[model samples]
Target chain A: MTRFAFTVEFDGRPFMGWQRQAHGPSVQQAIEDAIASVTSEAVAVHAAGRTDAGVHGIAMRAHADIAKEIAPFRLMEALNARLRPDPVAILACEAVADDWHARFSCTGRSYVYRIVNRRAPLTWENGLAWRVIQPLDAAAMHGAAQVLVGLHDFTTFRSVHCQSASPVKTLDRLSVEREGDRVSIHAAARSFLHHQVRSMVGCLAMVGMGRWSADDLRAALEARDRAALALNAPPDGLYFVRATYPGES
Target chain B: MTRFAFTVEFDGRPFMGWQRQAHGPSVQQAIEDAIASVTSEAVAVHAAGRTDAGVHGIAMRAHADIAKEIAPFRLMEALNARLRPDPVAILACEAVADDWHARFSCTGRSYVYRIVNRRAPLTWENGLAWRVIQPLDAAAMHGAAQVLVGLHDFTTFRSVHCQSASPVKTLDRLSVEREGDRVSIHAAARSFLHHQVRSMVGCLAMVGMGRWSADDLRAALEARDRAALALNAPPDGLYFVRATYPGES
Candidate 1:
């Protein structure tokens, strides 16, 4: 068997999420079905992250093992051709060691949340960004975001439905920036609890709008209670940007 | 009568074009119907440029003459409220001088064409950007674009059905820029003939792909014949970005 690593991009609007579900379609099912059609084998695909519904992916990494001897480029092209009319694409594909797993071999992940800080309702970016009518203080949001960086118990920022065994995780970076009416929040970490990025961004947005002070946010983190969460940003604005792997720049 | 100028944004995918059509929906019809619903008057809306179908607008300037005694903010808010579910928005609205016109008063216009130079098909940006599979030399495209800038009788670039009285128009600027996989072409001029920007971009793309040389582009312009046109780009990647008016910074 040969293992292949694929960098994938998807819109995440129509699917239920990355994981397969009995109720609705998913990105994983789409790819697996496409692979089955091409290789006649029901291969399961594994992704670095199982993004939520309506959350986009810029370069989500995944891996699948196949018994057929196929070139990586040919396999990618065939899968893409079979996945036509779907808002998913294989950006790059390469052979990987049999032991290299997409989920367990990743070292870091990064995400960006987009906010359109304007009164106008979104047109082109309707499902791609969050619209904040009131102006945002990006500088203030950035200053407050620093409090969430480094190792900490992120229970306040995790979803109640999260299945993680522990809430303690090391956040490598969190930054807020503004350009005209667009605000972007970037987060990087070794890993994240379910909905942690969205939850953190929600409170940062509150700080940006002056609804909550930086001290209030710091206090919420200390509380480590789900009820202490100020808000949970919608999935529409979140994007899984990239995943870093060992020995790869 | 009160002349209200509106800065509008829209995703043109669902519309036939910017102009009102007899058999299909148009951005003009949507906004006009919204205004009529708000103020019982069938007002005619005029835009700085009549963008084609599937082309987007960022800050398209438009104006309407209304007899109803309504504040600009109120009219804007009402229009937006009524334009629900449609991919259109009124970004800004204000009273303009009685004689100032959206079309005739416009001194300059600008457009940007987006291209994703990658092998992968687009996901979030599908129908919003043109995907070029081969590599592109943006620097070479920019160098060739300079040949089209300045006063020229661009019969080769104008559409056969273009309604402009004269083919002689000055192109103030044409620039190509690239950031990673994204390439943006910005064009600015006092005005443009129908399909002018798309035609220019098509030839520039050929230059980027090494299919045509800069001298070939210059010769095409000098030919000044409709048959000399190499290609006309699809409207999906084109965006009506801005309109400049007299005395407006």
Candidate 2:
């Protein structure tokens, strides 16, 4: 048996989440089914992060083991073919060391949240972005986000359903940038709590709208209480952008 | 009655094209229906250009006459509310002179055709780009495209269904640019014969793939016959990007 790692991309509109569920379709179930169709072996696909429903993935890292021998490129092509009509794609695949793990591999993860700040409604990007009708001050949002960078107790920014053992985690990077009517919030860390990025972004948006101040954001973090959270942005604009592993670029 | 000019945008995947069709749904019909729902008066909406099936519009200029008295902003908001569930939006709207015609008063038009030159199948961008599996040398395509710039009798590129009085027209700009796997071909002209941009792009792609030589392209243009046309690109990747007019930036 050999372990294979894959770079997967998917539009999350039709998916319930990244994990397998009995309620509805998930990205993991789709990949697992595709692998079964290709290799005749039911393999469990493990993703680096489990995204929420309606959360898109640009280059989500994942891995699975198979008894059948197949070239990496051929496996990727076959998986993509089998995953057709489901908006999931296997971009690249490579055989990995038997000890390598997609979830436990020591690495980093990055996410991006897209917001279309415009008076006009979205057309082609309807399900892909969050539209904020009020004018936003991106610079203010950026300033407020700086307070969340570095290690801290992020309970106020985490989901109640988070499975993490601790409420405190290191936030390596958090920044907000804007271009015209679109605002993008980029966050990176070794890992993150459930809904952490979306929660932080929601509070920052309030600051951008002149409803909250940077001090208010800092106080919310210090409160370390879930009720202190200002808002938890929807998963529509959230995207699992990238994941890094050892010895890889 | 006042003439209202609109800047429109839409995803072409769900519609037949930009114009009202007898058989299928269209962007024009969607807008006209929305306007009628708002004003309770049936009006004819005209566009700067009529796009083919599966062609998108980024900022297509169009105009219509509304007999009902309403503010331009109110009309735009109402139209958007009525256009819900459709992949169409009005980005901007304003009252214009009665003589300001969308088709006749236009000074220039621009289009961009997107080609994903990669081996991997598209997922999120499935219907938004034309996938070319072959490796494309974009520089070669750009060099070959320059030959078609300026005035020429583009009979080979003109569609048989084109109603233009003359196949002779001036191509203001034709350039090919590449960003990683995405290759965009931008074309501008005072006006274009039907299928001219798609036809030119198809041949340029042939040159890009090393299937046709630059000399062959010149020969095709020189032939001035529809029989010389090499290929007609699918409309899936084509987008009507801009329509320039007097006093508009």
**Structural similarity to truth (TM-score) of each candidate:** 0.99, 0.97
Encode model 2's per-residue lDDT on A1-249: one tens digit a residue: 999999898999899999999999999999999999999998999999999999999999999999999999999899988998899988789999999999999489999999999877887787788898888899999988999999999999989999999988888888889997899999999999999999998999899999999999999999999999988888989999999989888
Interface RMSD of 1: 0.8
lDDT of each: 0.95, 0.93
**True-structure lDDT of candidate 2:** 0.93
The parts of candidate 1 lying over 4 Å away from their true place are: none
**Which candidate should be chosen as best, given TM-score against the real structure?**
1
Model 2 residue B58 lDDT score: 92
DockQ of 1: 0.87
Candidate 2 local lDDT, residue A24: 100
lDDT of 1 by residue, B162-219 (tens): 9999999999999999999999999999999999999999999999999999999999
Clashing residue pairs found in predicted model 1 = none
lDDT minimum window of 10 residues, candidate 2 chain A:
A119-128
Task: Pick out the ten consecutive residues of candidate 1 chain A with the lowest summed lDDT.
Answer: A118-127
